[model samples]
Structure formats: C-alpha cells, structure tokens
Target chain A: MDIIKKLEWRYAVKKFNADKMLTEEKLEKLKQAFNLTATSYGLQPIKLLVVQNKELQKELVKFSYGQKQVAQASHVLVICIEKQIDQKFIHDYFARVQQIRNTSDEILDPFKGALVESFSKKEREEVRVWATNQAYLALGTLLTVCALEEVDACPMEGFQPTSYDELLGLDKLKLTSVLVLPVGYRSTDDMFATLKKVRRDLNESIIHIP
Target chain B: MDIIKKLEWRYAVKKFNADKMLTEEKLEKLKQAFNLTATSYGLQPIKLLVVQNKELQKELVKFSYGQKQVAQASHVLVICIEKQIDQKFIHDYFARVQQIRNTSDEILDPFKGALVESFSKKEREEVRVWATNQAYLALGTLLTVCALEEVDACPMEGFQPTSYDELLGLDKLKLTSVLVLPVGYRSTDDMFATLKKVRRDLNESIIHIP
Candidate 1:
C-alpha cells in the first residue's frame, strides 16, 4: 500500500489481543527500517530494544501507567539513547566511519576533528538531549514501517523512564528509554478505532508560498 | 512503494536543479501530511514556513552558511518552535482538546491542571528545549512524507537560528527556527546519488527478546 493509505489505516491502537503475534521476519524488517533512519550528522545515537516476554511486558505495563496495550501487544519496542556522548564516543563513531567506508584520516580528518571538538564543548545534558533527538527520528521511521506493514502500534512517552532504565538494567549500559511503542494487531473492541482522526486545519498549521 | 523501498530510493540530495519546482498538488499533500503529524498532549507547538521565492531563498542561503541547496531547492521548509511554553499555551491546548473531543471538565480538569503544573515547574531553558523537541517530531513526519512522495529532501541544522529568526520576523511570533529542510527533485549528476546506504547491523543496533 501507498503511504497515504497506510496512514489512513493506522491509529493509536488502544488494545491488543495477547494471542496474536508478529512473525520474526516482520519484526526483523522493522529493525532494519529503524536502523536506516537518518539523523543529524548521520550519528545514530539510538538503540531499540524489542521486548516480547509476557512477564516483562506485564511488569512494564505498571510502569507505563497500567496501559493494557503494553502488556497485551505482541512486542514493545523501547527506543533508548546513550546517557552521555563523550570524546571517546565521538572518536569511536569516526573510527567506524573510516572502517566501514574504507576512508583514511587524510580524507576524514577535518570533519572528524570538528565533530569531536563541537561535542566536547557541549554540556553533558546537551549531549543527552541531542542523542534523544535522534531517537525520535528513529521512532518516526519505525512508526512508518509499522504502518506500511499493517501492524498496529501506539507511540508512547507517558512511561516512567527513570524506573524503566533500572528495571531493564539499561543503566549499566548507560542507556535510557526515551520512548516505547507497543506493536500488534488492534483489538476490535477499542473505541478509538472508530473515531476519526483529529488534526489542525492545513491552512492554519502550514504557511505556503508559490 | 513500501516505506522501506521509498527510503532506499531516497538520499539527502546535496544539489537541486534550480529551475525545477514542485507542483501545487504535491505541495498541498505535503502540507496536509505535516499538519496531521501527531504530538504529545496533541499540542503542536511548531509551525512550518514553506518558502519558494528565489530572492528570499537567497537571503536564507546566507543564513544557512551559503548552502546552495537552500536557494536551489524548490522550497525550503523552516520548522519553528515556540520560544516559551507558559500557562496560556497550556490552557489554550486543553481548551481546544475539550472543544474538539467534546470532553467535559470533569474528565479533563485534572489533566489540565497537571499539564499546566508540569510546564510551570520546568525551567525556562527546559521549556525551549522541550518545544524544540516537538519541532523535531514535526520534522520527522515531514521527512517521511517527502520520502513517501518521492520528493528529495535534506534535513538540515547547519544554520544560524537567531539571525534567521530576525530576518524572518519570527521573534514577534515568539517562534525560533529549530530546523530547516530543503525539498525538491534531485540533480541526476549529484555524486552521492549512487552510494550504497551505510548503516549499522541489526544485531548491533537492536536487541530482541522472545
């Protein structure tokens, strides 16, 4: 299906039947789609955690404000960002860039130097926020993929991130959950399924010049 | 095309043919797509400015470090975020929510109070950063739409925001340019067109549990 049709078919699914599940191949496709998301400076600071265990989902549901969708959905994709971006992280990215692209310092020297210097000058909080921004880019890409694949999803930020990090042992990796998305087939009983989408008028939301 | 295919076909077009331009229908579709982008609390604190005039684009090109794409692309979309999020903005959002959702104060009163209190407790800089975060959401939505429609886009942040806001008279609106995207057809001769997409492996980027 085309994008418009996929978009029209999608909604913030409110409920999911636990019995239904997504195939491994489809889930892998979602991951690939997310990995390909573009970010500022091509620095992908986001990591996705795909959770499908029933016990963990049930535990996460409480942290997510008792949202049933979290527990019942086939999988919950947690989008996380590195807690800090230091000189080592920046150098490591450039090192990978050189290895992957087969380019030497003669070709990548100035850009890498400028990037590292700029990152070093930024406050730790600023670096975290920048990484979080890239996470949202990944979120958008994944959402589009889910829609295209006809998977039901609800993008969420209402969860307790601090507790989530601890519960998932993500703090050890210096990662923090920035967003959660529950994906599955939508239940027929969801009232929100029947409601029309509400959005601002196009003219009011956009300014155009021709 | 499926989203993955569309993404595969897309690239950050570094050069755009100056003479080529987007049609009115295509532009309208893009505007509609952006307006419908979802946001937290359904509060869209971002606005889009679509500029096509060559002279104005030339002025913006300087503000964007003389990036030729800014001036050559058929349109440059300036995503601006509210500089401040005060009680008034929160109240306005809840008011609209009530009107559109037909929600009574009995149901929304606590939410309204909580939202206002949340915004109030946030530091002034935090408010700007939060609003800037919302702008990135809109940027992601627009980029996805561009890819879906086969429109070449370059998501850019390499620009002077303060000067762009001043030149665009955005301060009066309490808005500041957070991100800029140049959208148009790509130049066939661009060197980046044929390069394979570079991304980390799924095993490295995503962790799966089943």
Candidate 2:
C-alpha cells in the first residue's frame, strides 16, 4: 500500500478491541523498526518494554490518567531511557560499532573520545532531555510502522512516569519510561474511527523557499 | 516492500547526488506525510520549510557544521515550530475542527476551554518544548516516508538553528527551526552506504513481558 494511504488510514485509536491480538510476527516487526530508529549520535539510549500481560496493563491505566486503551490494546509498548547516560554507555556503543563494522580504532577513537568527553560534561537533566528526544523518534517510527502493518495505535504521553517506573520496576533496570504506545485492532464502534482527521491545510503547514 | 525491509535498506546518506533530484510528485508525498504526522492533541504545531535553492542550501552548509550534505541534497527540509503556542492557537485548531467535523460547540467547548486554560498557564519555554516534540514526530514520519519512496535522506540536528532562522528570515513568520533533513539520492562513493547498520540485538533493545 502507498505510504500516504497508510498514514491517512491511521489515527490515535481511542478504542481497541480486546479480543483481537497482534500476531507474534507483527510484534517482531515493530521491535525491529524501533531498534532501527535514528537517534542523535546513534547512541540509542532508548529501550522498549513490550507489555502483553493484561493485569499489568490494567495496573498501568491508572498511571495513564484512565486511558483504557492501555488495558484494552493487545500490547503496551513503553519507550524508556537509561537513567544515566555516562561515559561507559558511550564506550559500549563505540565498542559495538567496532565489532560490527570492523572499523579501525584509529578511525573510531577520535569521534568516540570526543563524544565521551562531551556527554560527560553535560548536566543530568540535559542528558535526560536528549534521551527523551530519541524516545520520541522511536515513537514516531513505531507509529508509522504500525500504520503500515494495519495495527491500531495510540501514542500517549499523558501518563505519570514515576508511577509507571515503580510498577514496571524500571528503576532497578536504570530506566525511566518516557512514552507509551498501545497497539491492537480498533473497535468497530469507536466513534473516533469515522471522524475526519482534523489537520491544517498544506499551505498552512508547509513553506516553499526557492 | 515490507516495512522492515525498507527500514533495513535505509541509512543516513553521507553524500547526496547533487545531480539527482526528487520529483515534484515525490516531494508532494513528503509534504502530505508531514502534515499527516500525529502530534499531541492533534494540534499540528509543526511547519516544514522545503528549500530547493542551491545557493541558500550552500549558505546553510557553514551553519550545519560544515556538513556538505546540507548543500548537495535535492532539497533541505527544515522543521520548525510556532514561536508562541498560545490560547489563540488552541482556539484556531478547534475552529478548524468545527469546520471539518461539524461537531457541536457543546461537544467542543469544554475540551477547548480546558486546553485554553491549561496552555495559558504554561511557561513559554514549556510550550516551545511541547511543540518541538511534535516536530520530531514529523521528522520520524518523514524518515519512514522517504525510505518507502526510495529517497535517500539524512536527518540532521548538527546545524545552527538561529543561523538558519536568520538566513531563512523565519522569525518574520513566527517560526523557529527545530530540525533539518536533507533528502535526495545517495552518491555511490558514500562508503557508509555499504556498511552494516550498527544496531543493538533485538534482545538488547526490546524486553518482552508476558
């Protein structure tokens, strides 16, 4: 299907049919898409937690401000960032780069050293902001992927992160949830499914500079 | 092509073929894709500046930290956010919503009033951050669109936004550049094209909790 058609067919699905579940194959595709999302400096500080347990999803709905889509959807994908983005994290990325690309250390050392030094000097909040930005990129990628796969999804940020971290045990993993996406099949009676998408006109949303 | 395959085929092109250009039809698809990107509250707070002028792109190269790809691509897409996201912006969105959906004012007024009140209380910086996050979503959507269209793209944050704003005279439009993307065909000499993508294994990036 054409991408534009796929995009037009997608929306922030308000209601999901709990009886319809995503196949394992489809969920695997989403995992690959999220991993491939581009991040600044390719540090990839984001991690995705795929929650398929209905009880946990029910528990999460409270933190999500009573958005029942969290519990009704086939799965809730939580995009999280490492609690600390330190020198060791940067080193690990470059080491993986070396192992994968077989690039010489001479070619990698300068950029690696520079990034490690630069990141080490940044404030914790600044790092968190940077990591959160990457999570948004992943969210964006997964949203598109879900649309193409005919998976209904709602990208949400209205949740209380501290509560989610506590319930999901993210703190122990040194991670903090930044974004949540619930994906499944949309309910047939979802009123939002039939509403025309409200978007700005092209001229209002785009500028051409020749 | 499968979405996963298309994603695997995509990489940040280091060198764009200056002689190759995206067809007008393809560019139109990108504009539509950007407009259709999901944003928080569906406010559609982002704008895309499509630059095809070689001279302007050449000028942008310096500000882009000497990244020549900014100058060589068929077009440079600058994603910007409204300088001020005020109550009026919220009202305008609802006005459009009313025009398109013909939903009763009774259904819209309460949500509109709440949004206006909530946004009125936010700091200017807070609103800017929220709007910028939407721009990242558009960026992510466009990245997927570009990949599916067989267009080579480099999603860049290396540029100096203030310089871009001044050069493009964006402040006059009440817009601030938040992200930049260079899109076209990749040059064969771009060695990065052939290297394996460096990504974490699925187990490292995704945690499945059943």
Candidate 3:
C-alpha cells in the first residue's frame, strides 16, 4: 500500500495476537527508525527498550493500568529519556557530530558552546521536560513507521512511569520511561480494528493564511 | 526510494528555494495526515496554522532566532496548542466521536467523564503541558510524512512563542504556538542538505530483553 493508505489502515490496536511475533528483520527496521528520529538540537537524549520476554511483559500489564496489550503483543517498546542532560551529554553529542561529519572544532565549538551554555542555565526539571518532549517525538516517528511497515502498534501514555522505572531498573540505567508501545498483529476478534477512525475535519483544525 | 532510504535522505533543511511552493495537492495530503495523526485520547487540542503569505513569513524570521527557513519555505506550519482544554473541550470531543462512529453515550460517557474529571483537577499549566506534548507528536508525524513525500522541512523550536502568538494573532484564536516547521523544496545552493545525518549506533541506543 502507498503511505497514505497504510496510514489509513493504522490504528491503536486493542487486541494483539498472542501467537504472532515480529521478525528480527522488522525489529531491526524499528530500531533504525528510532535511531533516525530527529531530536532537539540533534541531542538524541532518548533510548529504546525492546522487551520480548513474556514473563516481563505480563508483569508490566499491571503497571500499564491493566492494559492486556502489554502482555499480548509480540514486543513492548519503551521510549525513555536520559535522567539528566548535563554538559557532558552536550559535549558527547558534538563529539558524535564531529566524528560523523569530519567538521573542524572551529565550526563546531560555537554551536556546541551555545548549547552547553543554554543547557547549563536550565534546571534539571526543565531539561527533563525538554527531553520528555523529544521522547514524544520518537513516539510519533515510531507510530508512523509501524503503520508503513504494516506493524500493529498501540501507542500508550496511561502507564505508571514510576512503577515502570522501578520494575525495569531504568533508574539504575539513568533512564526514565515516558511512552509505551505494544507492537504485533491485531487479533481477528479485536472490534476496534474495524471501527471507524474518529478525527476532526481538516477545515476545522487547520488555519490558512494566504 | 523505499521508506528507509527516504528517511535517510531527510534532514532539517536550512535554506529553502524561496520561489518554490507546495502545490495544493501536497498541502491537502499533509492536511489529511495531520488530521489522521493519533492524538491522546483523540482529543486533538492542536491547530495547524498554514502560512503561505511571503511578507508575513519574512517578517517572522527574526522571531525564529533569525532562521531564514521561516521566510524561504513554501509554507510555515505553526503547530499550536489550545490555550485551554476544559470539560467543554472533552465534551466536544466525545460529540465528534459520536458523530463519526455512532457510538452511544452509554459507551462514551464514562470515558468522557473520566477525562473531564482528570482535566478539572489539573492546573491550566498542566493541561497546557499535556496538550504541548501532543504537538510534538504532530511534529514527529509531519517530519516523517514530509520525508516520505520527499518534501523538505525544518522542524524548529527556537522561535519566540510570545512573539509568534502576538504577530500571528494566535492568542486571539485561543492557540499558542508550540513548534514551527518550514516546508518547501531545498535550495540547490544550500550546503546543509549534503551533510551526513548524524546518529548514534543502534547498539548504543537500544536495549533488547529476550
């Protein structure tokens, strides 16, 4: 299908086929898509956790407010933000940019210096909020990719993040979960798959200044 | 090109071909894509301002930290959040849902009531923050769609919101700009277009639990 038709086919799957599993090939594409997502200042402060262990998935359903898709989907994707985005994070990002671009420090320093200075003035909460927004960006990218790839996914935010962090040991890894997506095949019995997608009319939601 | 290659070809464009413009057909697809984007609880408290007027675009460049893409692109898409999302907003969403899906209030009222209760307890800033995250989701969706459609776009956050709100009269419309995207063809003379996309290795960014 073309991109638009594929997008039309996409919805938040309510019932994932428990027997279905995403191939390693599909998993790899998702990882690449997540890595390729555009982030603020290209800082890339997010990490993705691909959980396929059934027992762990079952445990997470409770943290997800009893959403069984967490347990039934072939894989649970967790999008996370760095616990702290300090000067070191900024320095390291520039290092990656230089390594990839072969750019000189003279050109990179002014840009990096500005970012470092800007981040320094931000409180931790400010930085976290900023990073969380980037996490949402990643979520948006994955949802679209999943649709194009014909992967059924339910993008979720109703989960308890503190419970997830403690259960997944994300705190030790200096990460915090902000979004959860269950990916697999939609069950034939899932009625939501056939339901009409509700949306505001384009004219109602968009303003044109000509 | 396939979607992956298309994604690899994407970048935050710097300079746009000032004379080039997005055709109505392409703009319509983008509008549909924006409307089709999966918002939180389907309460799309987001408005897309499609600015195609050249003089207005040029005048707003200063507010965007002097970024010229704001002036040179075909359309400057201002993604804004509703200034307030109250119980009435929740009620209106369910009404739309009922209109589209013919779903009865017997099924929708509990969900609507929960949302109303949730928002009633939140401070205006909190609701604004929630709505702002949805805007980022829209940004991510648009970036991916633009890439797939081979449209050049620059997603930006450096613009002064207060300035944009005042200049664009967004506040009068009960909206606040959260993100800016300039969409058009990239300039042949622009150097940033050729820069290799920088990203961390998948191993460094993703964790897999089997």
Candidate 4:
C-alpha cells in the first residue's frame, strides 16, 4: 500500500497481545530505518534503546504514567539524544567524511572549518536544544517505519524523563530520553482501532500557489 | 517499493536543481500528512507555512544559513510551534476533537479539565518547549511520508530563527519556527546522492534484552 494508506492503517494501539512478538528480521528493519532517518548536519545525535525484557518493560511502565502499552508491547523503543554537542562532535563528523568518502582535504577542509566556526559561536544551550530536535526527527521516522511494516505502535511523551534516565542508566552516557515507542501486535478488541482518523481538511492545512 | 526500500532510496539532498518542481498532488499529500501527524494531548500546537514563491524562498535561504536547497526546492515547509500554550489553545483542541469525533462534553470534559490543570502548572517557557518538541515529531512523520511517496526532502535547522519569525510574520500568530523542511526532487548532479548511509551498528545503536 502507498504511504497515505499506510498512515491510515496505523494508529496508537491501546492494547497489544504479548503472545505475538516481532521476529528478528522485522526488528532489524526498524533499526535500519531509524538509522537512515534524516538529521540536521547528518550528526544523527540520537540513540535507540530497544527493551524486550518483560521485567524492564514493566519497570518503564511506571515512568510512562502507567501506560500499559509499555509493558504489554513486544518491544519498547526509547529514542535518546546526546546531552551535549561539543567541538569534538563537529570535528569527528568531518573526520568521518574525509575517511569514508575519501575526498581530499581541498573539498572537505572549507566545509569542516565553516561548520566548526558556526557551531562554536552558538551558546551551549542552543546546541543541546538543536541536537535534541534532531533526535525527534529520528523518532518520527521510526514511527512511520513501524506503520509501514504493519506493526502496531504508539508514540508516547507522557513519561517522567528524570526517573527514566535513572532507571535506564542514561546519565552515564550523557544521554536523555526524548521519546518512547511501543511496537507490537494490537489486541483484537482495541476500541481506538475502530475510530476514524481525525484531521483538518486539506484546504485548511495546505496553501497552494496555484 | 515498500517503505523500507523508499527510505533506503532517499537521502537528504544537499543541493537542488532550481528548475525542478513537485507536482500539485504530491504537495497535497504532504499537507494531508502534516495535518494527520499526532501531537501531545492532541493539542496540535504546530502550524505549517508552505512557501513556493521564489522570492520568498530566496529570503528563507538566508535564515537557513545559505543552504541552496532551501531556495531551490519546489517549496519550503516551515513548521512553527505556538509561542504560548494558554487556556485558549487547550479549549480549541477539545472543541475540534468534539466536532470531529461527534462526541459529547460529558465524555470530553474530564480530559479537558485534566489538560487545563496540567498546562496551567507548567511554566510558559516549558509549555512552549514541550509544544515545540511535538512539532519535531510531526516534521519527522512528514519526512517519512515524503520518502514513501518518492518525494525528495531535507530536514534543516541551521537557521536564524528570530529573523525567520519576523520575515514569516509568525510573531503575530505567537508561533516561532521550530523546523524548516525543503521538499522537492533531488538534482541529478547532487554529489551527496551517491554516498553510503552512515549509521552506528545495530548492536551498538539498539539494546536487546532477550
């Protein structure tokens, strides 16, 4: 099916059957899809934490405002952003560009110097916020991949972050949870499944030049 | 091709051929996708500004740090978050929910009360930031839709937001630019097209509990 229909076919499933679990290949596709998600400057400052342990999922349920989806899903995916963006990140990005693409310094030097100059001038807070925003881009991409793969998923942000970081031991990595996604097969009786997708009319949402 | 292939086939085009433009139908689908993107508490705290005017796109390129794609793409999609999340916004969201779902206040009243209590306690800046984060989620969803439909897109953030807010007249709406996306077909000569996708290994990026 095409994208719009895939989107129509997907919803934030309220209940999932635990007996059904995603196969390893399907899970790998999701990881690849998220890795390919576009990010500003290609920094890709996000990490995906996949939770399959029933005990850990149950623990996360507490931090997610008692959302049962966290505990019931076959897997809970936590998208986290690096806590800080330092000069090392910018330098490393360019260094990789030179190594992988095998492009000469002439082609890469100017871009590297320019990026470092621009990034260095920004306030530290702005840098962190910018990096976090990129993580959301990754989050959105993963959600659609879940839909396209016909996996029932929910994009959740109602969790307590400080507590989740503690529970997941994210503080050591200098990472913080930005979003939580639960992917699994929906139960046979989820009421939300039968509801219509509510959206504004196209006329109101789109401004055409013609 | 399925979503997986579409994602693998697309890239964040670094440069665009100014002459190529997207068809009206594709643009319409993008608009529909944006409207359907989910948000926190269903607040829908974001608005999109579609710019196809070349002169306007040229101006936006300045705000986006001289990125040629911003001015060359068939259109620029500016996603903005509401400057403040006040009682009015919460009321408006529920009103739309009621209208679209054909539901009664008795069913919605409790949820509405909870939202008011929650948002009221949040500092204005916190609310704004939270709302802005949702905007990024929506942006990511749109990017995936673009890929599924074979529409080339670039998610950008290296911009001067203050200037963009002023130029787009968003200050009056109390909306600030959170993300800017340039959407269209990629240029044949864009060198970034041939590069391999760079990502952390699946084992490194995803933690499996099983």
Q: Which parts of model 3 are misplaced by more than 4 Å?
A: none
Top candidate when judged by DockQ against the true structure: 2
Interface RMSD of each: 1.9, 0.7, 0.8, 2.0
Lowest-sum lDDT 10-residue window in model 4 chain A: A201-210
lDDT of 1 by residue, A1-210 (tens): 556667667778889878899998788778877887888787778889999899999999889998989999999999999876777877777777777777779878899889989988988887888888888777767776787788889989889999888888898887899999999988888888876665666676777654
Q: Model 4, B37: alpha-carbon shift in Å?
A: 1.1
lDDT against the true structure, each candidate: 0.82, 0.93, 0.92, 0.82
Error of 1 at A4 (Å): 3.2
Quote the positional error of residue B23 for candidate 2 in Å. Answer: 0.5
Across all candidates, what is each one's fraction of true contacts kept? 0.53, 0.79, 0.79, 0.58
- Give the residue spans of candidate 2 off by over 4 A: none
Q: What is the lDDT of residue A66 in candidate 1?
A: 88
lDDT of 4: 0.82
| TM-score of model number 3 | 0.98
Residue A112 displacement in candidate 1 (angstroms): 1.2
User: Clashing residue pairs, candidate 3?
Assistant: none
How far is B1's C-alpha from truth in model 1 (Å)? 2.1
Which should have the higher DockQ, number 1 or number 2?
2
* Model 4: residues with Cα > 4 Å off, grouped in runs: A114-124, A208-210
